[model samples]
Target: MTVLTKPWIWSCVAAAVAYALILGLTSGRGAGELAYAALSFGAFAAIVGLGQMLVITLGPGNVDLSVPATMTLAATLALKAMGTDPGTAMLGLVIALFVGFGVGIANYALIYFLRLPPIIATLAASLVYQSLAIWSNRGLRIKPPSGLADFATGRFLGLPNVAWVGLFLAIVVWVVLERSVWGRWLLATGQNMRAARLAGVPVELVRALTYISVAVFSALTGYLLASFSGGAALNMGAEYLLMSIAVVVVGGSSIAGGNSNVPGVWGAALFMFLVVSMLNSYGAGAGVRNVLTGTIIIGIVIAASTRRVRA
Candidate 1:
């Protein structure tokens, strides 16, 4: 299919148009400010969405339910590691990465060795991570470092640096998916795991690596979010779980795997943030927002699934 005809591309265009319309109708002259805020906040969702994209590309019925828990744990651990020393924040970053790796290992063991379904395995892992997060948060309160917070909230060249980070990550994933042999292997494995194994694709290894990559991305996102918000909370990452999946699905990544739309995920993330921001501006309550968001996601998922069936 031509790029223009790709469902993901069209979904992105539609999202942009919807955002513009919402701004014109609601914000008037303040649209730019709202847009900037949305993009800044949306960067976190976009980053997490990339991770979700990788995992979902592993095939049908695959998802990472541990994302929110991983994010929460990373944020809390980072705050603990960064205590009273801005220069030592690297320690926190490293710790977050390590935690993510450990989580990935656990997930791999559960799915690969225990032979659990991906969803059930990840769901169970998520509970363990959540418990860790809760345990870590107990009697621990630390301020995020000034430098990290500044970097997260600062503007470089009139754009949020976090947004730039998100863009860079997307580019890296795009290159891996489009220009590298590993990308080909990943797609092939997703398309037909048994066939890929027969063809010497190392299916198990690819799946394992994908899980690790997703965990690392989730950890990074958690750090950035904590820095942006100036502190970490037990529920800080709860919202991201659904948002990450929604962006990937809305961006045209196949639920059945074997395909991904990297650029589209970014647009979908921004669109989701805009919708939430607009609703907030209109004073919509949390319940209303949740219902609306859920309805929209369901619609998009149904449409994507239908298209896949038709194809």
Candidate 2:
């Protein structure tokens, strides 16, 4: 496909233009500042969307519903472990990743061994992770390391360091999904699992590793978010679950699987965040904002379904 026909490129351009117009009409004084803020905040959603994209690409009806819980638990654990020591902070980050890895293993076992559907298995896993996060939060005081906080909030070339991290992750994921042998195997598996299996494509292992990779991504996002916010909270990752799925779908990824648009995920993330920002600038309440967001998501899903039918 030509560059201009790529959904990611157009979606990004549309988002940027729409954001500028909204800022000009509503606020009229801080377009640049608001743009920067939107991009910075949207980076978190983009990162999570990337993980969701990976899972969804596994096949139709596959999704990782445990992302929010994994992120929250990782953040809580990291905060408690850091406690003001630099060395301890790194160790804490590692420990949080390990926690997420453990959850991935559980998810794999439930789905692979029990023949459970991915959605139900992940939902059950989410409950476990959420319970653990809540239990960990009891009577705990959180103070994120100053160094980590600084890095998260710091700016380079007018963008936050967190945004840079998101960009780097996007590059990595794009390369893996578009330019590597593993990418071909994953696409083949998603396209036709039976065919892939017959061709010796290790479908089971690929699906299992996809879950683990998503968990790691979630854990990393949690750490970045906690550091950016200077602390952790139970609700920090709550909004991400729907947002990630929405971003992936709106970014032109096939709900049926076998196709992914890496850059489109980034654009869709920006678009969603910009919509929220614009509504807030217009003094819209949370209820109205959510309603609008939901409506947009429904529209996108319908469009995607229609496109698939036509194809």
Candidate 3:
């Protein structure tokens, strides 16, 4: 019943604090800026973690990808919306969500309907998304739209708007996944599709919908990123796909399926963000960042897998 009773939670907190301290000591960046960076990473990681939750908890075939594409497309759609009237912007969000959903549906159809492997289907879809983003951006950076740029830069009660959005999203997702009947069905389907189908759980539908949900979340994350970054560009979603998976795995979810821990996802995301930000502060290059991040994630996954094996 006590908070400290959870080893996973305590580990995440300790990791985050230690990361910040290390950065502060090594880079002379000051505790204040390091703290702010930690928050920023936490918010970003939350969105990424959500994507991981969707894929892992809702995957139909023990695999999920296309996260990066969905996010990039969503950010592009938001940018396009900014070029339109107020009414259009609203419509654009809807369209963006639809597009994201469509991506998911396509994945499902390819895997179940066409009998393609999940990895193949998702990888193909990811390529399509990457292609679309590259073509649209025309090798240019997504600039912040003048009208909506304020939302990204504006801070409310000391937190950036993106942070607030992340908070709201986390709460909403927590409620939906924990309180809804459909949520039970989702978990059931993820745990055992054949069993769920035998019990008349509409297995394929749930599986497809899971992908759709992930797509929607990815898109939403993209929208937030565009708003926060002042626009979107190519490969914007690439970094997140790996990070999201790492977060989920580190947070204690098996890549294969079953468990869904919302709070753990939050902690893992924060911890990851802190690690990356801390490394950045230490003047680590992107290559170094990738190496360190990947190493850490692999170690976590191995440890988790070992624990599962023992238990």
Instruction: Indicate the residue-level lDDT of 199 in model 1.
Output: 98
Writing each residue's lDDT as its tens digit, candidate 1 over 185-278 gives: 9999889999999999989999999999888899899888888887778888889988899899888888789998898798888878877766
Q: Write the per-residue lDDT of candidate 3 for residues 77-195, one digit (tens) a residue.
A: 65665653443445556766877888888878888888888778888888988788777766465565555567666778877777777778888777877898777887887788778
lDDT of 2 by residue, 105-217 (tens): 88888999999999999999899899899898773548788887788888999888888989999999999999998877788888889998999998999999888888888
| Lowest lDDT block of 10, candidate 3 | 2-11
User: Which pairs clash in model 2?
Assistant: none
Error of 2 at 143 (Å): 1.5
Model 1 reaches what TM-score against the true structure? Answer: 0.92
Cα RMSDs, all models: 2.1, 2.1, 3.1
Task: For model 1, name the residue pairs that clash.
Answer: none
Candidate number that wins on TM-score, 2 or 3: 2
What 10-residue stretch in candidate 1 is worst by lDDT? 1-10
